[model samples]
Target: MKVIRAAVDEMWSVMGQMTSAVFRHGLPMTDKIAARTALTNFVLHIHPVRVRRSWIRMSYTLCLGGLSFFLFIVLTVTGLYLMFYYVPSTQHAYQDMRDLQFVVTFGGLIRNMHRWAAHAMVITVWLHMARVFLTGAYKKPREFNWGIGTLLLLITLLLSFTGYLLPWDQLSIWAVTVGTNMAKYAPIAGPYTRYLMLGGTAVGDATLLRFYVMHVVGLPLVGFLLMVVHFWRVRKDGFSGGL
Candidate 1:
């Protein structure tokens, strides 16, 4: 009997430990408990534990930055859906676009959503930056954060531009060629820079793969890291509203 009781006690302790690890504070009902729960959560902790009601009002923030982030999420989900049908080779890319348009179920909608959401994100991020500047939120300690936000904006544009070439049509080809030609005016390393961008002297298979890789992997990784830092800084710097 003694041994059985000891085993039961040990079992209960083990279960309790597992439960606490999973649930953190077991759940919170009151304001104080809710605050503690937020404090312990990684996602929730990104937002402050408290906020002034006036500071968070919709009129003050307009939520442009949040909407921009929401658009990015939409783009990512839709982009992933489109990727299974896309091939980055010049020979197959146009055919792949047609397959996405007519062959795959819901592919047209997904592709359109990705394209539109990308456009919306560009506008939204621009407005978000404008709001920050108009509010004088970029002064002093926030200046570095502002620079990071600027980099994120540029990344957003580059991601959109790189994606534009993946359709591999005459229009896309001409557009990228014209866009890259501007690099040739940069002096000494200009031609080399264009070569690096095109992966050759002209936009062809190498350029397609380069843009696809940057669109799907490189740019997104860098943009995501900067976005993480931007959000962290926003939380650290505190909202400038109600000032």
Candidate 2:
């Protein structure tokens, strides 16, 4: 019996040491411990460890910004799934869409989710800006973060617009045509901007490839860097509690 007890105690001693080495801190049952845990955690460091209960009411912030970020994540995942099969050529693009919808497992569902989530993100981002404006959250030290948010909103719209051409259908072409036409009204840089975007006088193979690269690689990279900065600034500036 003593021998068995000794073995059990030895096992528990090893377990305790292993847990401490892995976790660094045990359960955060107290405020001090919780703060310590938050400081040590990568994800937790992005948010303040403490805030008054009254400061975080749903009506105050509307949670729109967070929802928009969540939708972006959903779009990224579904977009990646679709990217495996999508071709950015005038020839195979529409046929690939058909195959994705009819042949691949969950492809149609993921596509629909990506589509709707994108639309939802646009709405949420706009509403988030509106909420911030209404609450006067952009008045002081938060102006920089607000600017970042604005840029993110623009990037979101561009991402959605660029993705509109991937299907390479009549509606897709028409939509992109109408959207790009608006750029021609921008004064001195209008025509040049549009030409640069299309890579020619009109939307063709070059336009399709350019849009694909921007939609998948270029804009996303810029947006992701801005997002990291935005989140970091939010952590620094603290939440703009309601007036």
Candidate 3:
């Protein structure tokens, strides 16, 4: 029992060191260990190393950016749950949606959560951008982050548009037709871009597969990478509240 107690204490000591290395708090500025840990810690990197009082004020930041990220997490979890039962083929997609709504336990709830969360994320991201613009947070050093944010907004819209067709219903079909048609108004590459998106002259199996891959894989990966850089820039630029 004495040996066991000693081992357990040693284990706890190691655990405490691990925790402190990643989450240093109240350490002196001269502490090299804390500074080194801060540089490499993923959690610490998400936030500024030195925080200003105005940065934390609810009235200043308004938490819209945080809410948008939370909604994204919700959509990812619910989307994974949905992907298990959904088949992207035009023949199966609508029927699969029907089964999820009626046959699968709690599937409808999860699907609704995903749908509404997507909508909410769009709203929150827009509001977050608007707030930044209103606060003059997009000037100077933040201009690059603003450009990234604009790309993120376009990505969000494309995600929504691509996902609309997954239901494989008349409404979705007609909606995409109208949307893709508008792309033809672009300059020289407009028609080619529409053709590439459709994968043919019309929406069919190839179009469904292409949209499915993009909605599930391509766009999300790009969006996530952008978000990482976006957060990193926010920390590096010092949150804009100082101005």
Best by lDDT: 1
Clashes of 2: 0
lDDT (C-alpha) at residue 206 in model 1: 96
Reference-based lDDT, each prediction? 0.91, 0.90, 0.88
- Give the TM-score comparing model 1 with the true structure, all chains together: 0.88
- Over the stretch 1-243, how does candidate 2's per-residue lDDT look in tens digits? 999999999999999999898788789898999999998888788778888765688888778888988898898899999999999999899999999899999989998998899899999999999998888998789999999999999999999999999889898888988888889889999999989989988888899999999999999899999999998998788788766
Give residue 210's lDDT in candidate 2 (0 to 100): 95
lDDT for model 3, please. Answer: 0.88
Pick the winner on TM-score between candidates 2 and 3. Answer: 2
Tell me model 1's lDDT, rounded to 2 decimals.
0.91
Per-residue accuracy of model 3 over 142-192 as CA lDDT, tens digit each: 999999999989989888889988989999888999999998889999999
The lDDT of model 2 is: 0.90
- Candidates 1 and 3: which is better by lDDT? 1
Among the numbered candidates, top TM-score falls to: 2
> lDDT tens string, model 1, 1-243?
999999999999999999989778766888888899899998788889888898898887899989988898888889999899898997799999999989999988898899889999999999999998898889977998999999999999999999999989888999999999999999899999999999999999999999999999999999989999999888888777655
TM agreement with the true structure for every prediction? 0.88, 0.89, 0.84
